[model samples]
Target: MKIYLAPMEGLLDHLLRDMLTRTPGVDICVTEFVRVSGSLLPNRTFQRIAPELLHGSRTPSGVPVRVQLLGSDPACLAENAAKLAELAPMAIDLNFGCPAKTVNRHRGGAVLLDEPELLHEIVSSVRRAVPAAVPVTAKMRLGYNDRTRMLDCAHALTSAGAAELVVHARTKADGYKPPAYWHEIGRIREAVTVPVIANGEIWAVDDYVQCQLESGCDDVMLGRGIVADPGLAARIKGLPAPDWDAIKPLLAAFWDDVLIYILPKYQAGRLKQWLNYLKRIHPEAGIAFEHIKTVKDADVIGAWLAEGCPVPAAEPGWTKA
Candidate 1:
């Protein structure tokens, strides 16, 4: 199975991607979307979002990282893609799955699903702009407000030369709710010729098993699921899973990176955001989060972490969903 790490805007960036891919079983990762509005963005813009481009489009762990672009204007996207291709990314991915309101108001994301023809134009345009060796992929929701045009969108993307597709299995209206409608992904998989990677609502190993059964897709793209449990992908492949003892050092290393890269004011929030997700798997994470939830000083939090911030055994059966 090809397990990909999803591009979570504001949540997963290059630094976090580096740390997460250190574990085995993560094959590839897609960077967060770079909004292409009108003009061709400078090389720095692409490099800023995905510094891995400067390092052969691979993370520190050596996993290839694909750059994702979000926009509606076909010509503009093509121009930006061509300029970005100069940096030699592993691939270029289109973002048709974002559900944010501001993005939709600008006619950028899932809202574009209503017009499959436009999706075709955008994908085909980018495909022509980039080199043949660099693949073009796309991620999309079932639809904008409903699933009426789901298959039409899928067919349009593949026909326009999308190498692969990642379907989130929910409409824009669903908005991160539980029960991600994996059955819908199964239908799309049957309809599309290229590989279909199932996404959405996979939180644990059991969820991954059930998603594979329901979606009938061997490939899966993980977002919050892997972020919450770093050992999730390894567990799926029956590799050794990292316990709390393994996580302690990671937490400290993460804090060090945060201090160096993130602004002093927002550094605390970044660590807390990750810890909030970790709480879902390890109770010890919840304790760590609570201890620093109200503390804003990075040094103070760093001190707490240096003291070996909570490392208790995971609760019995924490490995399962």
Candidate 2:
């Protein structure tokens, strides 16, 4: 089974992608969506979102990274995909699953699901424009507001030449709610000829098992789950889970990487954002975040982590959803 890292906007940037792809069982990493508008974007824009494009489109550990594009316009998406293909990424993934209001307001993400033909046109245009050796894929929610016409949408994407399809198992209106509707993916898989990857709310190995059983798809993609437990992908692949001590070095490495790549003013917030997710899995992370949540100084945060933020004997249960 292929385990992919979901492209979460604002969270799964290239820094985190580099970190997670180093872990075992992460087959591929998808960069956060590069928003396409009226015109072709410059090469610098693609490089900014996926700097790995400079180094054979693979993470430091040699895991492939696919560039994902989000837009509604067929010609513009094709133009951007053609330009990005020149960079030789592992694959091109089209984003039809984003639920952010800002993205939808601009006719960019899940909102396009309301018109299956539009989704087909956009995907087909990108598929034809890029080299045939470069695979084109699409990720989509069940629908815009409901599951009706979901089969139509699935068939539309496959007929449009998407090499693979990832179904997030919820409509745009569902918006990250409980019960990811994994069984719904089974329907899409049956309808389409292309491979379907299941994604949504897979937080643990048990959840991964259940998602596969329910969706009947061999491939799975993880998002927030990896943040809550950095060793989750390793665990899913039957590797030993990283204990608190093992996790500390990764946190330090992440801090160092962010400090080097990101500007000073934004570094602390990125660390804090990761801590917020880490708190769900480790007691030490909770204590660390509480103490430095308001601190904007990355140096101070680094000092605290370097000092070994005291870990209590017992950790709180994972709660965030």
Candidate 3:
């Protein structure tokens, strides 16, 4: 099955994408949605979100990165999509799945699910603007406030010429709560002709298996799961998980990459954010997070990481079958 990485707005930026894609089992990485507003965005704007476009649209490890756009305007979304296509992205993904209230209040993200025809118009416009070879895909939740229009939304996207559809199995009201409705994805997959990819709440190899079984989808997307455990994709594929010693270097490498690619002031927060996720899976990560959660200086965090967090020799009970 193909495993794609979800485009988590604040967490899964290009820097993190660079680190995760290098670990293997990640087929494609989508950029955080570039909000297309009143006018067509400039070339620089697209580049800022997806610098991989300049390098064959692939991460350094050669994984393809698709550019994702989020907006409510059909013409404006199409115009920006056309501009992004000019840069030769692996693919263009439309975001109809984001659940942020601020985004929804502005007529973007999951709120658009309430308007199926608008979804069709927006997808159709962009599909027509971009070259046929350049695939245009979309992501969406079950519905805005309920599942009343779930099939309609799925049909709208596919009928509008979307090459693929990714369904995050929850309504806007569900937010990031547990017990993702994986079975609900099966219903949508059965209703849509286009390839359906199931996403949401997949945290481990077992969760991946159960999601595929329940959703009836051959493909799956990883989000916060990957952030919490960098070796999850590998483990899902039956590859050995990276040992703590091996992971320490990757953390350092990520730090180095962030320092070089991002501004100094923003660097510490990024590392802290990643640590917050990591702590869920690694005890050592919890200790590390506590150590640097309050420190705003990137240099101090780097020094702490360089010293290495302590990881136990035995596997945690939660990881066993």
Candidate 4:
């Protein structure tokens, strides 16, 4: 099965991509969603989200990174998509899955799911704007308020020339709630001709099995799951889980990279947001989290995590969904 890394706005930056790619079974990485509206953003903005584009749309380890666009305007999106295509990304993914209230208020992200025809126009325009060699794909939730119009939206994107679709298996109202409803994703795959990737609440290898069985999709994309366990994708591919001895040195290396790349650039709170995920895999992460809660300095927090925080054990029968 193919394992694609989900684009988490704060957590999945270039440094994180470099860290995770060293682990096995990671096929592709989608950069954090880039908002497209009005004018195209500056080159540094695109370069920051997708530095891999500088390396010709692939990571130093040779893993491909796709740029994702989130917006409501077809004309603006198409224009910006063309500009980004010039940089030669591996692919362009449309985002109709984010449930952020600010984004929805602007008629972008999940709100677009409510307007299937408009979604078609946006996807079709973007598809036509880019070269044929550059694949255009989409990621979406079931619907805005309900799953009633989910398949219709999927069919709309597919017919509009979307090369692939990743269904998050939740409605806008659901908002990361329990029960991902992979069955609904299976229904979408049956309805559309393009490849469908099941995404939502997959935290472990067993959940991968259940999601595949339920959605009948050959690939799975992870968001929170990968954050919770860095070795998750590798484990799902039948590789041995990273033991504490191996995990320690790897996390130490990740801390060094984060301190150099992520800390100085972001505010203390944003840095803490990243540690909230990194702590999941590190030994003594709980202590590190407490340290982060009280410490405002990135260096202090990094020192705490590096000083050997005890890793929390995974709860029995735990699953992200």
Report the number of the highest-TM-score candidate. 1
Q: Write one digit per residue (lDDT tens) for candidate 1, span 1-321.
A: 999999888889987898789889899999999999988799999999999999999998899999999999999999999999999999999999999999999998999999999999999999999899999999999999999999999999999999999999899999999889999999999998999999999888899999999999888999999999989889988899787778877778888988988888788889999999999998888887776676776766777688788434342322111
Global CA lDDT computed for model 4: 0.82
Mind giving the per-residue lDDT tens digits that candidate 3 earns over 65-95? 9999999999999988988998999999999
lDDT of 2 by residue, 1-321 (tens): 898999888888898987777667789899999999998799999999999999999999899999999999899999989999999999999999999999999998899889999988998899999999999999999998998979888989999999999999899999999889999999899888889999999999999999989999989999999988888988888987787777777778889999898888788888889889988988878877776666666656677678776544433442221
Give the candidate order by descending lDDT.
1, 2, 3, 4
Going through the candidates in the order shown, the clash numbers are 0, 0, 0, 6
Candidate 4's displacement at residue 28, Å, is 0.8
**Where is model 1 more than 4 Å wrong at Cα?**
310-321
Tell how far residue 241 is off in model 1, in angstroms: 1.3
TM-score between model 4 and native = 0.88
**What TM-score against the true fold does each predicted structure earn?**
0.95, 0.94, 0.93, 0.88
Best-fitting candidate, scored by lDDT: 1
lDDT of 1: 0.91
Q: lDDT values of the candidates?
A: 0.91, 0.88, 0.88, 0.82
* Candidate 2 wrongly placed segments (more than 4 Å): 310-321
What 10-residue stretch in candidate 4 is worst by lDDT?
A: 312-321
